[model samples]
Target: MLRVAIQVKELISSNVTSALDSMSSSAKMLHQLQREIEEAIIALEGERTKTERNLKRLKATLTQNEMREADWGDKAKAAMDHDREDLARQALMAREDCREAIASGKDDIAKAKADLKEIDEAVKELEAKREETREQAKAQSAADADKSGCSDAGASTAEKRLNRVSQMEKRTEFATEDTASARTNASVDREIDEMRRASTVDAELAALKGGAKKAPAKRARKKA
Candidate 1:
């Protein structure tokens, strides 16, 4: 039973290895796709970095514009107090232009940030996929090697055990047959002994009867 169990375990492992190997081609394809995705994501990230830098510059410019607008507002108020309407109008226009620049910069920054986040996530996902595929391949290779080795070892062990069991069974059967044959010979010998004893007793009884009959005849003849 122990040997049989080992053989069964080996067979199962071998089959599992075969099944996994069957998927090797598919796994390679997945690995390739994962690598491609990673490369593409890397390239996209490089581009995204440039965009992010541009967005950063734009944001800095926007901040500077806001400060300039505040300065312009103060100047415009002073101009109004001094009764210079043309100077006040020019200052207000410059402030409005700064506001528009700040708004445009904010929009660009928001879009760049969103794109960067998406690219980062894609890069992370691709890395995960690549790692997963590599681990799977390694595990499968190890399993296949182990299964092949175990199957060979277990098969040999099981065959030896089976042969031993068959030998034992044959020996047992021979012993039983021999014992039965011995019993048969013993019974035949006992029957022959009984027959010989019965024959001896019958011969003795016949001789005695013959002697008595002869004596009775002789006595009759003498009396006559």
Candidate 2:
């Protein structure tokens, strides 16, 4: 029974940890989703702008085509008035081409409008989801922060360890400086001692020379 209880407790703990992890991951996903949605909206808006421009151009071209058809109609009437049936037939045939162009332009306009509407609807849906995800991510973040005191605790431990390492480095540097100072002092003392010994030897040599010269003078006087 005790073993079974221990196993159950471990399982519960594992489940709790897993749930927290899942929540954290979900929060991260929300951030990615928001960015993706925003980018998608931007792209969609750009495409919409392009569509509007294309539609405008198409309408302008359609107007030109209609004017062309009218011009052909006038030409046909003038040719018929002059009794030129061949010229009138050619003008009518050209007008048919202009009419076809106008029809195609109208179709393009319709498609563009439909496409823009769909894009607008998609943008709205994405924006709504973006807001929803943002709120959920915020709530999840707060909850995760509360539960994961481990992060803060770990940072604190790292800070203290760094401080300790810094102190040890300082101590080592100070010890090295002190040792260098002691070595320098010892070297200076040795040099001073050597200088003193050289001075003493010179003084002894001067005294010995004086004693020898005086002894010679005394011997000469005694001989006299």
Predictions: Cα RMSD each: 56.7, 46.8
Model 2 lDDT per residue over 92-181, tens place: 667767876888889999988887787677667667755765677688677767673546565464455334322311222322457767
Cα lDDT computed for each candidate against the true fold: 0.55, 0.61
- Please give the lDDT score at residue 137 for candidate 1: 59
The candidate that achieves the highest lDDT relative to the unseen native structure: 2
TM-scores for every predicted model: 0.46, 0.54
lDDT of 1 by residue, 1-224 (tens): 22322322332233223323444323333344334435555665676687678878878888898899799767766665555656766666666667667787788888778767765665565456556556665665565566534345644644553343233112223224577678769988878866765564355344444554576579899999
Residue 162 lDDT in candidate 2 = 34
lDDT of 1: 0.55
Error of 2 at 160 (Å): 37
Clashes of each: 0, 0
Lowest-sum lDDT 10-residue window in model 1: 165-174
